[model samples]
Target chain A: MTPNERLSINQATIKYAPLREALRVTADAGITSIGLWRDSVEAASLPEAARLLADSGLRFSSLCRGGFFTVPEGRARRAAMDDNRRAIEETAQLAAAGAAGSAAVLVMVAGGIPQGSKDLAGARAMVQDALGELAADAQAAGVTLALEPLHPMYASDRAVISTLKQALDLASPFSSSVVGVVVDTFHVWWDPELFEQVARAGAEGRIASYQVCDWKTPLAADVLLSRHYPGDGVIDFAAITHAVKAAGYAGDIEVELFNQDIWDTPSADAIARTIEGFEANVALHLGSLSGDARP
Target chain B: MTPNERLSINQATIKYAPLREALRVTADAGITSIGLWRDSVEAASLPEAARLLADSGLRFSSLCRGGFFTVPEGRARRAAMDDNRRAIEETAQLAAAGAAGSAAVLVMVAGGIPQGSKDLAGARAMVQDALGELAADAQAAGVTLALEPLHPMYASDRAVISTLKQALDLASPFSSSVVGVVVDTFHVWWDPELFEQVARAGAEGRIASYQVCDWKTPLAADVLLSRHYPGDGVIDFAAITHAVKAAGYAGDIEVELFNQDIWDTPSADAIARTIEGFEANVALHLGSLSGDARP
Candidate 1:
């Protein structure tokens, strides 16, 4: 199958796998693209990781992330900025190695409320400022920065931008291709305005990427679940994809899972199952619909 | 303090307490209202339960719940309907026993996905149909049917009405006084349209209840933290309360905590600490604000 659409693997699902092993496993799964994270890519080093993906003809869909700008001054914020700069440079290197795109999207997980600040709005401003700086670097490198809106559980500690509208608003000053929102079903399926927001993202050409997962119950009331899997829970994937497609997005559809159960499985097996699940969950939706009916 | 506002203690917070202890402890807390489960009230018998609330001068702000209307067959649906009727009768008994104006708000926790059914839309329709029947009964008894939209996580197996807008839309055919949304901050805080919805609820006089609690994080992937104290987490209570007040909701601000931590504590201690936390959080926010801005 010379698949016209692209399938990107978020490395977190097989987080336990070595970077090279993960690339090999993902490649074997027939997923065309892979999203890389700082820690994992750094562990493998950019040149070595690039060489491996090059040898395998794998695509770097996007960089895992670059943002945590809500620290209260001093070292952490500066360190985060420096780290983000490095992420851009790394994305540039990955792009140089034949990833087949003018710019890879630099996904930004906006930071949360700063310590001692009940002012969430203020922290949001800090994210915007950080993004402004990163956008300049990203623009220079011909890379896009995708701001991901996490679930509300992470609003205070992980991301202040917790909705598509919120992310779009923050990225308004930038060109759609320079900065945009990642429509992750795991984070946004519960949103009442999800359809409208997805439409908005599409209209503005702000849909940076799309991720799919289901939300299950008996959720631990303490930590946010990164443990979502497609079809294991209840997310209206068919409905969301239809909306996203209606909005004119022609980008890669990425599957990013954060489940302990999936990770416990062997990387090869996990990768294989995930690819199967993705094809079943996403492809079936696409396949069932006529091309004209997608939107 | 001749408290004019309605203050209901949801039984789940004191789930460990014998129904009797919950009543007496709630009374001692100086809160006038209590929300009881049908099972608890039925177990205690209507007369004895009435006497318990009467002796303590406690009121029934609402029946713990009655609408799990998404069952597939005649048997389960009929059983749920009958159970709701019994809840209404028990609520009338409480009203007759000097708990005047303390009529029940039938809190509906919509049932989850039917085993072997992917029809969320169908389940939601079933809930609406059930509400049509229950609303008539509740109206006749002078009780309000409060459609408490569970968080989206519960949309499948709990209440499919996962948003204030959807709940309000369902209740539109009924009088606003008879059908309303339970404004639970824990469930609705992350909603980008919260303020707008609250205004709509208040405009229609459909704010049947206002439940408060923090949205604690680091939640385990599968379980929602039902038990949370107000002002203890990321939710912006000060903002929500301000919107509720501005919407003209002159009702009791009920403290509904589902945390196991609170339940394991002595009922008296839990009640005492909750009251203190409620007051302190309000005061902290109040003092932090400028001018005569009221939240």
Candidate 2:
């Protein structure tokens, strides 16, 4: 049962699985690529995780995250920058260890407004400042820091960057290779400027990662975990996938669901469902994968 | 105690109150203006509601709503348009019945994506079409159809228009008086382009209403009811209120809360809290209201 050649299972979609199990199940399911989260990588230790990933023979699509840079200038801020630098190193090493076509991309979630603060613009500026501080390191390590604009619902407590245009504007100061943006459908499908921003991100050559998940209403009590399998929700994947393809994003497209029910499913079954959903809702619009060969 | 002379209590802040009781509580709390919901007005019958509002001697700031225009062309769509027309007539009558400075403004929530349909763009176009069908009637009644862009979380199930810029763009082809946009803080506070759009709305003379409510995360189980009283959450009222004021929206500033807790509070207590929240979080930034006298 071969999954679409471009399909990459984002590990968070099967959250309860550790790094070894996640890689084993993904590869066993005939998936060629996987995106890893920091927790699982740290649990296995970076070197061992890289070895496990190498044995699994799956391309490393991206590291789950790297940024929480909205902290004010202080001990906490210094700590966050240091942590991000470590994440950049992890991304570089894992991408090196994976099969051919691995991508050295580190997804960044600009942390919400600092606690006790209502200055959203200031928090956003801190994200800009963090990017400036880290661009040189990311470029040196050949890791693209992919700034992810989370949905506005999480603006106050999860991420201050809430639109693709805002993410692109923040990514403007650095080189596209060093600073790019993540176009996660769940976070951005509602954006009126989505298609326009997708085109702009494409023109700028900064579409570092394209992640797909579905958004259904009656959002879970924890809105963070409300994403569903593609085709299980109302997202028009045909349009968005075609737009991303038109944007020239040839990297492995990642399916990243955070729903609790999906987590309870056996990793193999989850992978099976993901593959089916991807083929039905997203893969059709991805065009042919022959030209998608990446080193 | 005099509430800010420009403060208006949106009836939804005290959802249980009947139209007559809502007016009584608001006026009894020394609030000089009110924004009425259609359900309560319909409950009292429009003519009787108008009479009660007049007897209360409070200015009518605006009507609570008028649009759910995202339905596909069918009997449902036709019914929605007709309902909106009645809403327009209700606004005209209510404004006339209130004290001087009443605004015949009808707030419009562009309905969610149609059931089982994934065509957001198509649904939005339907909103544009509905406006075209209703604009002349609104103009004929001297009523402003105020387009309210709900937050992106509600984009799929509640409102497809999720940003002030989108609302303004949709309102562009119509006269500002006949078609304007709502600057509701809860719906738009997370927008990165908010200040810019507010200024543009001002320049276009399209800001028909300015409503304020705070947004706290860990949103209610039903996201629609998560609104908080001002100053109780992370919203920066000073920045937003100043932006709205700078944008030339001198109309009544309404406090519209939907939280079950706020709704359960006694009507008089809720109005008192609304007044307190408004004074502390918003009114200070509004400058003196002496020059804001509008008829």
Candidate 3:
């Protein structure tokens, strides 16, 4: 793996920090790539935020979102699609400015149920329709839409795509080159088919990006943001990573943690710790696989 | 579905109540069938508990559980298997006396990480091995082993099988009639393949039992019990039920809730409200599907 296949930090890691500070901290920690969530980008003025990434010499791996299309007909549906269109435009703008790299993808979190409807299948259909429209926009802009399958627990209020296989199936009809998957370990580690899906995504060149974080048990719902760093939880990251590698996916391995505990720590400490955790996790993983290869 | 195929109450809904009180409340609520947890059965001696079930004339849908095979090899493994064997014997004893029906399966919640083991695959293998042993015993007793696939969030410590597909796959190698699956809505509602798996389970004659409850967003881990009653949350229960029906499943639809809030309320009220919620949910769901059907 080359430096290009190294780590990217999701801005949500230090969501409390100003975007500029987060970028500087990421760069200082020697991670040259970053994933910027849409909410944070929206919080900042686009052009100004674009300048920060440019000046910092950081690669935007993905523009963090564009999908919440599970809305009832009429105003809600139109409004969601309209908002998504704006998000696509923003992603394109970031890519043009080198903030979001030319190769950077637009990450999507498929929305949950439409209010007043328990028809999850209908909502899923709406997501597919919304994705089709967004994919068209993304294609025109040379941006790949990376569908992130959230944890199943969030199927109701968050992303409806809760498994990598499900996400790939949803994106299958679309051109895999333009619409792909974001394999986030935190969200998918519990999936029994994680390795198979990761391999499948990689085989089709549909692995838009790879993200890592640990899954803690006895998790608090309110600690929605609290994630253990990679190697600190029960997930078999090494096996999944090996599967991804076996599939020939050579892309940036991003460390995107949404943890209140990690966020409350100093930015310097958090970024430094993340980098170390990444190194340790990968090293331990490789060592275990290679029968005594050690860092 | 006949009265024989009507709803059963899983006593874990009133797990907080004393066994006698729980039985009384369930019988008074006109729930002719009820399931009891292992701890609750032990709390009230097995013979006494059998007598109570006999007196109330409520059939046991399933024995609440008997599986922790993931524990590392040693005394713990021996103990878990032994305990499960005892549970099977108890289930048989109850069946022989006509306290529970001959078809009452033992629902298995496969245990999570054993102490000092990070090998999820290994733990899963251990679970399979344990089930292999228990399956023979269950067959001898004429009781089926219902593999209950829990929500992925509980994958680490509660159940490794987090999807219906995974559960069905695990039980497939065994005789479909001997080893089966319990389709609990709370555990499987978030599953994208819920409908497909239900059809498969029913087609294979592996639908040992069907359970229903709702998944509350912003789930609390401690009072981890489900708070969302049927129709109170986002799951499309009607579609799932309809699919099961179409697939030739004619088993009791068990109402199993574990809400702390509901438990604190009057047990009688909880049972009544649960039944009402079930009816309302069925009506609302059927009405929605029919489109022209009025309230």
Residues A1-295, candidate 1, lDDT per residue (tens digit)? 3232466778887889888888888777667778777788788888987887787677777788888888766788889999988888887788677457423778889887876556676687888888887788888887788899997667767888888888988989999878888999888776656778888888899887887766776563434534566777776677777777778767777778787777789987876776666666766666533443322
- Per-model CA lDDT versus the true structure: 0.75, 0.92, 0.77
- Taking chain A of model 3 alone, its TM-score versus the true chain A equals 0.91
Name the regions of candidate 2 deviating beyond 4 angstroms. Answer: A288-295, B288-295
Q: Write the per-residue lDDT of candidate 2 for residues B96-145, one digit (tens) a residue.
A: 99999999999999999999999999999999999999999999999999
Highest TM-score against the true fold, candidate: 2
Docking quality class, candidate 3 = medium
Question: Which structure is stronger by TM-score: 1 or 2?
Answer: 2
Model 2 chain B TM at 0.96
Sort by DockQ, top down from the best: 2, 3, 1
- Once fitted onto the true fold, the runs of candidate 3 whose alpha carbons sit more than 4 angstroms away are A1-5, A99-102, A283-295, B1-5, B99-102, B221-223, B282-295
TM-score of chain A of each: 0.92, 0.97, 0.91
Q: DockQ, in order, for the candidates?
A: 0.35, 0.59, 0.52
Chain A accuracy of model 2 expressed as TM-score: 0.97
Question: Model 1, B1-295: lDDT tens per residue?
Answer: 3323345677877878888888888887677778777778778887888788778777677677777788876888899899878776776676666376575577767777777665666677787888788877878887777888776656655667777887888888898767787999878776656778888988899998888877755553444545477767777777777777777765556777777677778998887777776776543443322332322
